[model samples]
Target: MLSKIRKNLRAFSFPLWIVAASFIGTIFLVWGKGSVSGPSGNEVATVNGEGITLTEFNREYQNTVTSLKKKLGDNFRKFVKEDDIKKITLNRLITRKLLLQLAEEEGLKVSDWAVAKYIEEIPAFQENGKFSLELYKKFLESRRMTPQTFEDMVREDLLIQKVLTAVNRAPSVSQFEIKELYRKVFGKRNFKYKLFLSKDFKPQVSQKEIEEFYKNNREIFKKGERESYYVLKFPKTKEGEERARKAYKLAKEGKFKELMEMKPQPLKDKELIEKVKEKGFSFRSQENGLELAFKLKEEQYKSLNEVRGEIERALREQKALEMAKKEAETFKGELNEETGKVDVSELVKKLKLLPTTNPEELLNAKVGKKLILPVEGGFAVLVPTTEPEVNEFEEDKLKRLKEFVLNVKRDSDYQNLLNLLRQKATIKVNQSLFRSVQ
Candidate 1:
């Protein structure tokens, strides 16, 4: 219950710090920066005249990495490229700076009293439904934040909210539109269908067609370029790196392992092969840094015979899909117009309708009509059994629907506002400085 309240408070553009002995109550405080320094040192970007320092950029970058790591697990770094992450993080920082600049220009101010009130209202910061000064101090200490620093962050967040709220007005919805929407969404749909598996109609692809496909898409058969290196693992410490560098220097003399008090291990052929197949894995080991002296190998493409099977499979799927469409066309005239129905159980495999497979197309279908739509590994032929009927509405559902629509409008407006500010602001980004962010 306390967590629920804490989450709600955090959504109000204010950070609430709560102190417990364990790592239970936590607050994600938005860090605020001072006035931008001149373009002399490592400034990754500048919004208007305010420069984003390397220190600030690194902090945000690390925070982004942590969040992504949590969300994607081990695949975070694997799927997302370093340069891509840097670009996204830099854009976000610039957008934030632009928003803050706009807030100041619009004369939006947040008082210390408001900030204090917001903090006190957080259930996590309260004891017996009242604010606790001791808990506040402990929380600040735990986060290594001074009271003034926390207050300044809260002030900036509130100012940004003020600017956003000023332009974000709730959209009005009419009764007729609401009723129509409710009918479209909550209406009962009864559809009977016959699913056709693509694999069942696998067309025999000729050898000549396979050759053509392989010729046109030659890059698919080409192997990824690889680098083979004997990695000498060492602990990440000052002494360890020094020793590893000495070993690297001795590599020229062919006494690399002898000098380093180690045996030369053979480069794992199987491991290198696996790395070539999987694009996600990085073979370079940064800890020892000995992999730098190794040789790089050019990639070799597979022979035509090696990739013939793959091309044949792709061709078969293409032909099968075309055949499925033709098969669906044949069933079109089977419908009896006067009765508005046909018993297709004997002719085709009958199945129930599922929302996952083209719900919109199936729901809005005309009676006694056939819709041949693509499904996973197959095609489905749908026939609506009955006309769509509106379900009874509830007051709570109507209220929620209105709020959802209004929120969508406000979100769109916010994005447009950001784009306008980005175009108008004198923003400059130094690509070289991005490399220095640790």
Candidate 2:
């Protein structure tokens, strides 16, 4: 009977499903106060008396904040409101706590060496394919993370994850489920489009809406958010020579470094050297010796104003992302926020991304020149240029837009599902650990 019970439990375990969702749903949290007094001495939250530590929570919290900011940047606070961050953090921590508790109930386990080995392989802390002590120290200093703290966090994370894997074994998903999952996950149609340009859509816009849109976003469409005039080479714009001369003079004078310091760097990034270098490495004008010079963090661009186009472009790209999201909503054929369900095949058919070919090109498909893609909450178009546009954002933008909108609805849906399941769960939490959180 014991063997039968174990076998039956195995039947219910769906390791693939759990593992797929495990890291995909990476933790997002805020710093929790206190530390683990000893290895697993106290629990932050528990399910059936299991311990989740403050240290683990803090580590994940920092990562969550870092990951979110990387993704949303200036807008992270806007989308992930303070209350939402805390709520998500608490919920994430609690869920992990419960999962670990379940793992313990089943006696799932991992070795310290497994975690140690994994740590050694992390590229961020590595130098030339090996862990570098210097890189490790610099990283911790930059994030205010310490070695002991980082190790405990990684260990707990690995142990919990390993335990979850043990509890949820393979072959539990079953062939029937896999077949169904296959369609749900991969059922998509490709779109082929003959772009209806802005002009085409322009006439359809109501006078009132157009005027209203213009009024609210007049600033958005303003030419040259950067006040600098373009240098129209061959017959450049007025002041074009002056602008070029100014940049050339700055480079010649070797004052590029001083000039760089005078410009505004984002307040949040001032303390972050690597991140600042990342932002400033790319320049506006064509590459020359100046590009090589700026490669040294101590070296700067020709002049701040000379690279005003870069600044303006960066800022414009930021605004465009938000605008793209807003426009995706209400786009026809979209998985609207309301329904949250899309017959993706239908979309593929509509978008003409289906496998069917256009015979006119004779064994070659006539790739649409310009096509506006409507996402769950944004609209985007790909316009082919003579040259590849800087930061094509071709793949990343579409993926992000989908994650932004589809996930909005998907998140709520999943949470509601969890709520229903939680009612049936026998779980407990360490209230003292979280009650004082800001």
Per-residue lDDT tens digits for candidate 1, residues 1-438, read 223222333344432332111111112211224232325567887777688888667766776687679878968888888876776567667766776787677555677788889778867789998999988899899877799877776676666665555445423568777766665555655666666667779589999999999889888888877554443555667876676666656655554335335543435666654663344223345644434233334466788899899889889998997887677666654433221232222113234323355555645667777777665666666667777555568788777777777778666666566667765777666656666665
Total backbone collisions, model 1: 0
State which candidate has the highest lDDT. 1
User: What TM-score against the true fold does each predicted structure earn?
Assistant: 0.57, 0.37
For model 1, what is the alpha-carbon lDDT of residue 292?
A: 23
Worst 10 residues of 1 by lDDT: 20-29
Which window of 10 residues has the lowest lDDT sum in candidate 2?
A: 226-235
* Alpha-carbon lDDT, every model: 0.61, 0.45
- Give the distance in Å from residue 104's predicted Cα in candidate 2 to where it truly belongs: 1.9
Candidate 1 accuracy as TM-score: 0.57
Error of 1 at 97 (Å): 2.0
Model 2 alpha-carbon drift over 4 Å, by segment: 1-20, 23-46, 50-58, 137-149, 164-436
